[model samples]
Target: MANVTAKDAMQIHGRNPQHLVEKIIRTRIYDSRYWKEDCFALTAESLIDKAVELNYCGGIYGGNIKPTPFMCLLLKMLQIQPDKEIIVEFIKNEDYKYIRLLGSLYLRLTASSQDCYKYLEPLYDDFRCIRVKNRSGSLVRGHVDEFIDDLLHEDRVCDVILPRVQKRYILEETGEIQPRVSAIDDLLEDDEDTEKESDDELATSTRDQ
Candidate 1:
């Protein structure tokens, strides 16, 4: 098999480097056999590291095509918080056709996961608009339903979301989601500790009050 570089991956979807990295990382981790071994196993950490590295490279290259707002939209699909500002910004700033293309691809790729469907369900109106305008076929729709069914069978949601939420909150406080240079293991540990501390604090505060 050919080694899939970030560029090659992006070319597959006509996406930008950063978006390709993000998608590759997410998909690889999702398919990893030992992802449950740790919060950031070697394979998982490598993906995050690669994404940051590629993001930097793309910025420095200057001539590189930026990841489409559609890619960001897919990333946002994994988020629980209502990122209305980001979504609105993408709609206003991006080409409608590209946005629809990206959305269609995202739905097709993630359609086997029930959790993804749950996240996307709220955006039904937006999805419908894309479907109608883009003429995305029934095949993509089938994939979407399949993903939803898969999620229903697993009866589980992504374990990474809460920690990501915390990470996002911390980044929001700092006014940017800086890609940290720490090892994946360390990052995962820090997130675990944060979770523990949060639970402890919640319990303590609840009892105290």
Candidate 2:
């Protein structure tokens, strides 16, 4: 990892580096009244529930609609002061695509460009069939890497602004890759009521078909 810092990148964007959370929230607009009614001041830890319930991954869930829980949780991670180690752990755990998606999003937003390339490049082979919403307002199947490709290369993926991550070799000189701490080991799926919508339950329309 180079000595690249998030603050430097954030400064180039001309926004206060500390207020990245506000940027995420202000940039997105979701039609789910549930979101408007809720989703304010949610801690990064609290957003895990929503991320787990997110069964699909896509830039858009419907026509002109906002991103899904995968994106929302990523945004929330930015909001609630996430621990990079914990988020990296999420990326390594392949049990759930949405969780990994959240981790990937975190890295894209805050990790060094070198770290992003080192970690995310290999996931290009992940051919898991997750659900996505197409432009004609149809639900369809897509691969995880297909989404990752755009995220790695494009300035904005999933209609979210991403600060350019420069390479960071500074950390390497310190001779210690930060030890991974278990910040979220206790986050088990206990909320049975919040179980994700099944594939059969998912409809062609994000709101209503």
lDDT of 1 by residue, 89-156 (tens): 32332334333233333343333223233343333223222211112212122233232233233332
What's the lDDT for candidate 1? 0.33
Question: Using Cα atoms with residue i matched to residue i, what is each candidate's TM-score against the true structure?
Answer: 0.20, 0.61
Q: Compose the digit string of candidate 2's lDDT tens values, residues 12-94.
A: 23544334434334345334443554555565566666677787765544544555655555545554546777787778878
Worst lDDT run of 10 residues, candidate 2, spans 1-10
Best by lDDT: 2
Q: Model 2 segments beyond 4 Å from truth?
A: 1-32, 60-64, 165-209
The true-versus-predicted C-alpha distance at residue 78 of model 1, in Å, is 16
Report how far off residue 181 is in candidate 2 (Å). 28
Error of 2 at 123 (Å): 1.7
What's model 2's overall lDDT?
0.60
